[model samples]
Target chain A: MSAALRLHRADTQPPADLAGEFLARLDRRLHLPQPHRRQVLDELACHLDERVRDLMVTGVTEEQATRRAVEELGDPMVLARRFERAHVAPRRRRIMNMLMVGLASAAALTGAMTLRAPQVTIRSAVYPPPDAVQQVPQKPLDVQGLPPDVQWGDFFSLAASTSGKSPVVHWGALRELDSDNFGPGHSLGIDPLVDQKLTLDQFLELINTEKGFVADNRIEYREEEGRLVFATTHYFDRRETRLVTYDVSELLRARLGGDADNPDRVPGAVHEIADLIRALVESGMWDVNGGSASITTYGTKLFVRVPQRLLPRIEWVLEQAADAHIGAHQGASVDRRQGDPLHTPRDGAALPPAAGSSTVVSVQLQRVDPAAARQILNQAFDGVPSLKQCSVARWITVDASSRTVSVSATQRHAEFVGRLLTMLDRPGADVVASAESSMQVIPLARVSSETMDSLIRAIAGGSTLYGREFRLVANPQQNSVIVEGPTGVVTALQELIALLDTDWEEPAKVGAAIGR
Target chain B: MLHKDAQRDQAELVILSLLDAQGPLYGYAISKEVSGRSDGQLRLTPGVLYPLLKELESEGLISGSVEEVHSDRKEAAPDAAEGRKRKWYRLTARGRKRLAARIEAHRTWRRVIDLFIARDPMDHDQKEHGR
Candidate 1:
C-alpha cells in the first residue's frame, strides 16, 4: 500500500503517542475557542501525518519519520506566537487606537471652543507703545537736581511722570546711532549717560553727543510753539552730502604717458583720471550734471564732493582703474597713500582699504547672453571674500542691448570670469570644430518610439542653450529614433536610450520562485 | 540576509501565485509542491506555512474547505468513518487581482533600480570632466 494510504489508515486509529503529545502542546498554546482550536489542531495533525508518510516513503522508519516530522514543525511556543500574531490584535496597537481616539476628542473640543470664542482678540500682554508721538506741552522738571547715579529707567520714568512728557525712545534709531552704546544686558541702562547731572535739555544733548547720535541731526532739542521738544530726525527729508578725498596718486602715475617725469603731466593725468571718474561713476549723482556730486583734482588726488551713498562707487571706480593700470605695467612702482578716514555707507563703520580693487575688462559674448553670463559669474564668485567685501553686482555691468559684460574685478577674479565665459560662450562653429556633429539611429525596444521622441526633444532642447545643435526624428515604423547632434549630445542620448530601452524584470524571481 | 518582515511579504506573493497556478491544495501538498519545484532549496516548514495560510485565509484572499480522505481499499464506503480530513485552500478572485498588482509593482520597482545600476560610472566621470 502507498505510504499516504498507510498513514490515512493509521490516522483512523489514535495517532502515535509522540505525535499526540506534540499536537496537545500546540493546541494548548493556540488559545482559541473549542471549535476553532479543534480546526487548527486537525489541520496541524493532518500536515504532520502527511509529512511522516512522505518521509517514510524516502526510506525512513515510521517511528523515526514521525519524530523527524515533529522536529521539522519547529518549537510549539514559537509557532503559537506566530499564530497569535496573525490571529489577534497586538496590545500596542490597541493602546495606539485608544490614544488616537483621545487625541481626536481633544482636537474636536478645541475646535468647538474656537467656534464659540470667535470674538477673542488674543493680544500680547506686553504690547509696546508706538516709538514716536506728537510733541505736547508739559511743565519742565528740575532734572539737574536729580541724583547722578540714578538708573536710566528710573530717570526716564521720573522725568516722564513729573513733566508729563514721556521721552519718545526711538529704539531702532538708537541702535543705528551707536550699536555699542547698548552693550549686552545694558538695554535698560544708558551706560555712557550715567553719573551725569545736567538740565533736562543738557541731559538729552549729552545722551545725543556721548552716544554718537548727532549724525544727520538724529537727536536734538528744538523749540517749537515755545516749548523745548526732543526729537530724533529722519534722513528721508533731505540727502546729506560729504567731502571725501581719494588718494589716486598711484592711478595718476599709471595714467601718465612716456613723459612720466614731467611735472605738467602729473596735473593733466590727475584731471584726466578725475574726469574719467566723474564719467564712470553714477552720472545722476554728479554735481556738474545737475546732481549733488562734484569731482575735482588737487595734484594727484581726486576730491569728490558727493552724497554719502556715492562715496563707495567713486572709490570702486578709482580702485579698478588703478588695478588695471598696475596690471598693464608690471614693473611700475606707484605710491599708494592712505586717504582720509570715511564712514562706510552701509553701517557708518570706518572704511577699509578701498573695499575691493579690480581690473576692468569688457567681454563681447558670441553665444551666451550677457544677463545669463552675469548670473553664472555671480554664482561662481559668490561668497568670495573680495566680492562679499564690496557689492559684486555693482562691479559687474551687463549690457543686454550690445551682448556685452563689463567686469571690474581683481586680476584673479577677472581671469576666472574670462575662462568661465569662454566655456559658456560656445559658438556653433567652435562646438563643431571641437566635437563634430554625428548621426545616431537608436532602436527602442522597451519604450515606444513616440514616448522616447518626446523625451529626447525635451532633453535635447534644453541642451541647445549650451550650443548643442540636435535634430531628432522618431521612426515609428521601425520603432527607432534618428538623432543628428553634437557628438557629446548624441553619445549621451545613446547612453540614455540604451539605459531606458530595457525589459522590466523582478528583482529575485528565480530565487523567490525557488521558494524559501 | 533578507529581513524577517520582507521575507514574510515575499512569501505572501509566492503563496498567492502558487495557489493561482496549482488550484486547490492541502497544506502538506502545497508545502511538498514548493519544495519539489525549488529542488529542496526552499523549505516551507510547517511553522511558517500554516501561519501564513491562516493569515491569507483570514484576509479573504484565499478560501479553505475541509475534505475527507477515504481509504483506497475497494471495500471502504465513500461516507466511511475510516477517513482523515484535511483543509484545502484555493485563491479567491480578489487573490488573483492582488497577485497581478503585486507582480506589476515589483516589475516597476525593479525597472527603477535597474536604471540606476545600468549607469556607467566611467561615462559619468567623463561627463564631469567635460563640464
Candidate 2:
C-alpha cells in the first residue's frame, strides 16, 4: 500500500473514490487481455496517486486533489478507446496488409508483362500471277493492271521469295494497325515496285504503306540474321511519353512579386499559371482532357509528359505567358503611379483629384497582433503627405479583437499600408536579427542541383546584393545546393525551396482561386 | 489551446528527446519534467501520455520495467499491505536513432516556417517607419 492508500484507509469519505471509480469505468471499456489491462490500470493508478500526493503537499485537501487529478486524466471512456486502438486494432492492420500485398502483386505482374517481348512469326506467301502479265522483260510488275490489294500481295510474295531472308510478320501489330480503320484508299501511292531492282530498304518503305496494313512512320524493321523483323510503334506506348521539366519559378516570382503578401498567394499563383498553360495549349493533347499528355508541378517547376512533337508547343506557350505576365505587371505599375484613369482600382474607387485617388480598404493581419500593428500603422501613415492630406488618423480604425485594420486614404497610401501590414505579419520576424553569413547545404529530392542552381541564380539576381552579400554553388554529384549568405537570406531560400519542391499533380485545381 | 493532433505529433519527439536526455523515468516524473521544461505550456495528460508510451513500448522503441514500491505509511495504517507498482521507461537504441532523425526533420521544418514568416531585409525602412 502506498501513502495514498493509507490516507484512503484513514478517511471515511476517501479521495480514492474518484480515482477508483474512474479506473473501474476504464477497465470495463478496455478490451485488452487481462494481464495488459491490469498493467495499464496499475500504471494509470500510480500516476493518479502521485498527482494527488503532489497536489496535497501544496495545501489542497484530499478530495479536491483527487477530483482534480481524475479530471486532468480526462474522460475514462476516451482513454479506454485510445488504449483499444493502440493494442487491439488488429483488424485495421490486417486490411492494410492485404492492400499492400494486392498492390505488390499487381505491380509485379505489370512489370513482367512490360519486359516480355512480342512473338513474331516467320512465313512466306506466294500469290498466283495476274492474268495477261504484259511482262516488260526488265521492268517491275505493273500495279495498274490489277486490284490494289492483289498487287500488294503479288509484290510482297515475289520480294519474300527472292530476298533469301524470310519476312517476320508481327501479327499482333498488324491486327492493331488494321483495327485502326485505315481502309484501302490510304496507301502511299508511290510506285517503288516500278523498278525491278529495288533495295531492301526501298521494298520495306513501299510495304510500310501498302493498303495501310501498317501506317506510315509507325513501322520499324531491321534484318535479323536470316529474317527481316518488323514492329509497330503503338501511339499509347510508354516510350512515346516524353517527360520534360520546366523551371517556371522565375516567371512565378516575377508575377507574384519577390515576397508574396499572402502565404496562400504562391500556390494560388502557381495554380493560375498551370491553368493558363493548359487552356492556351491544345486541349486534345492533355491527359486531364482525355489526351495522352499529363502535367504535374513540384515546387516552381512544371513536369510535362506528352509526345515528343508537342514539346515545342508547350515551351512556346509558357514563354509567351511569362512575357505577357511580366509585361502586364510593369505596365500596370507605371499606369497606377501616373494616376492614369484607365488603371483605377478595380473596387471602383473614384479617381484622384489632382493629388491621388482615395479608397477605403480593410486588411486582416494574419501573423501580427492587431493592437500593436495598428499603433505602427498610425505612425507610418502620418509621414505620408497624401495620407496626411486625407486626414489618415481620423479614417484609420483598428479592431484588436478581430486582428484587422481599416484605412481610408489615397490609392498609393492605402496600397502602402497594406504592403506594410504584410511585411509586419511575417512568421519568423524575430529570427532575422542575425546578419552573419552562414553556409547551408540544401539537398534537393525532386529537382536536380543544376536546375535548382539556375533557379537560385534567378532569385538571387533579383536582389541588389547578389554577388557581394550572397553566393551559391550547386554540387551536381551530391544533388545539393550550397548557399553562403546572411542567415535571413538563406532561411528565405530554404522556405522558397520547400515551397517549390512539392509534388502537385492535379492540373485542374492549380491556381483555381486567383481573382477570387 | 494547442490543437490535439498537433500536440500528439510533437509529443512523440518531445518524449523521446526527454527520455534520452534524462535517462529512465516513470510516467508522473516524465509528465512533470515536460511541464517544468516548457514552463507548463505542454501538459501531457494521462490520456495522451499512456497510450503513446504503450505504443512506443509495443514498437520496441522504448522499454518499460515494473517495480514494487513499498509505502512509508506502514506505522500509520495496519491494513495497507500490498506494495504499489511503478513502471519506469527508458529509451532503447532504436529510439535514439529515431530521435536524431526526428530532430533533423524538425529543424528543417522550423527553418522553412521561420523563413516563411521572416520579413524581407530590403523593407527595413518600412519597419522603421512603422516603429
Candidate 3:
C-alpha cells in the first residue's frame, strides 16, 4: 500500500482499551438502575470488541483499532449525557435544554447591544490663525516736503504733459540743482519694447512714440556711384532744428578694412558695416536713460535725438565712438592683396584708413534691397558653411535698401570677421579663401600661468578632448593660448575654455580694439 | 462516526436498517456489520451504542433476546473452552417503519442540498441578463 494510505489506515485504527475505559467513565457518570446498567455495559462491551475486530481487518494493530473504535464514540462525558438524555425523565431533560437556550439568547443580545452603541473618537487640535493683512493705501503718497531751489514736482509735471524743451530743461536743471539729492538708488530704466526683431524705420517709430522724438530717414540712389546712400535726421520733440547727421558709409568702409575691387569684398564689407552700424545704434538706443540721447543707424547714417542742453555731451560721446572706430580701422593689418592689379580699387584707393579722422564721412552704400542683402549674406555663407557651426551668424545681419549691416557678436566672432574680411579683399579670394583666412591668434584670459601650461600640454599632446586634433601654441610670457585654425575650431576651443572657467574673459576683449 | 448529537438521533435508524437488511444480529455482530458497510467510516463504541440500543428496545422499535451460542474459535484459541451469552437485536414492525421514514427524509434532505450545490440554469440566465 502507498505511504499515505498506510498512514490513513493507522489514523483510523481503533484504540485497544478505549471502549473499556469509556464504558467505566460513562458508568460512573450515569444514574441508572442496576439491571439496566448491567445490560448497557454488556451490549456496549460487545459492540466495542466487534468494532476493534473490524478495524483489525483494515490492517491496524489491535491496540490502535480498539482506541480508534472508542474515539469514534466521542467524549465519554458527552456520550454519557447523550445517553442520559435518551433514558432520563422527560421533565428534567426539558429543564436542561431550556437553560441552554436561555443562556445563548442572553449572549446574543449582549453582542447586539455592544455593536449598536455609538463609537467614541478623539478629535485633533484646533486650526491655525490667519495671516496678517498689510496696511497700505490705495493711491501713492503725495510729494510733500521739497527743497526751495529744486522743483522735482515741476519736472515730473512737465514730463507728464507735452514733449517739449520745458520738461527737458526742468529735468536737467533739477539734476544740476542737486546732483546727489536723489541718492545712489535713483537709477532709472528707460527700456522701450524693442525685444522683438524690428526694422530700422519701425525701431525709429517706436523710439519716437516712447521717448517722444521725431525721427526721419531717407535712402537716395546716386546715379554717379550706382548705389544708394541713406541719411536720417532726428529732431527733439519735433521742434529742435539742429539735428545730428551720422554718416555710416565712411564707418562701413572703415569697418570693411580693404580695397573694394574684389566683388566678394564689397558685399561682405557692406554686410559687416551695416552690422557694425546697427550694433552701435542699438547699443546707444537701449542704454539711453537720464542725460542720455537716443540714437539709431539706417543705411549710411545714425540719427540722434536729445535736449538742447545735452546736445554737446551727446556729440562728444558720438565723437569718442567715431574715434574708436577710426582707431580700429587704422590699426588693421593692410590687405596684402591691395597690390594685386586685377583686384585694384575701382573707386580709387579709398581704403578703410584713407577715410581720415573727419567728423563726418559719407560714401555710396549698396543699391540692393533688404532681400538682396540677405541673398548676398547667404551666398557668403554658402562659401563658408563652417560659419553655421558656431552661433556667430545670429550676431551679424544685413539690410539691402540701406545696405546696412549689424554685428553684436562675441569678441571671437569680431576677430574672425576681421580676418575673413581681410582675406576676402584678395583678387581671387572667394568665400572659402576668406573662411580659411579666418585664422587668428586667440589670447587666453584669467588663466593662471600654471593652468595655461598644463592646458597647452594637454591640447598639444592630444589628451584633454578625446579624438580632437588641436594645434595650439602656449605663450607663457603673455599668459595666452595663440590658436590658428578654422573659425569653428577656434570657437570650439573658446567654448571649452569658457566651460572650464566661469570667470574667464574673452580673448577678443584683450586683443586688438573693437573696430579692428 | 457522525457527531454525538447526530449519532444520538440517527443511531436508532441505523440499527433498524441494519437489522432489516441483515435480519437478526447480536450487539457485536451489528457493530461489526455497521463498520463494514460504511468502509470503517462509522464505528459505535460501548459507551454510545449501548444506550441507544436500550432506548430503541424501550421504544419498541427493536426487540432483543439473550442467545447462548458455542464459540466458533479453534481448540488452540484462547477463549475456545468458554461459551458466551450475547443479546441479539432484530428490527420490529415499528422500527422498520421509522427506518423507511428516516431514509425518505434523508433523500429529501439530499435534494434540498442539491438546490444549493448544483448550478441552476435560471441563476445563470439571471446573471447573464443582469450583466
Alpha-carbon RMSD to native, per candidate: 32.5, 29.8, 48.4
Q: What TM-score should be assigned to candidate 2?
A: 0.34
Model 3, span A354-458: residue lDDT tens:
111211111123333434434433444343322223323433444344443343334334333433332222222122233331222333333433354454443
True contacts kept of 3: 0.22
- Chain A TM-scores for all candidates read 0.21, 0.28, 0.19
| Backbone clash pairs in model 3 (N, Cα, C under 3 Å; residues 3+ apart or in different chains), count | 22
Across A67-176, the per-residue lDDT of candidate 1 in tens digits comes to: 88889888775677567555553332222322222223333334322222222121111112212444434445455554554454455555555555445444454455
TM-score of model 3 relative to the true fold? 0.27
Q: State TM-scores per candidate.
A: 0.31, 0.34, 0.27
**Best candidate per DockQ, number?**
2
Residue-level lDDT of model 2, residues A385-438, one tens digit each, is 222333344545676766666665544445444544554465555445665544
Model 2 fnat? 0.38
Interface RMSD of 3: 26.0
For model 1 chain A, the run of ten residues with the poorest summed lDDT: A118-127
Query: What TM value does chain A in model 3 reach?
Result: 0.19
Residue A336 lDDT in model 3?
34
| Per-residue lDDT of candidate 2, residues B21-96 (tens digit) | 9999999899999999999988888788998888777756789999987644332223335755789999997576
Full ranking by DockQ: 2, 1, 3
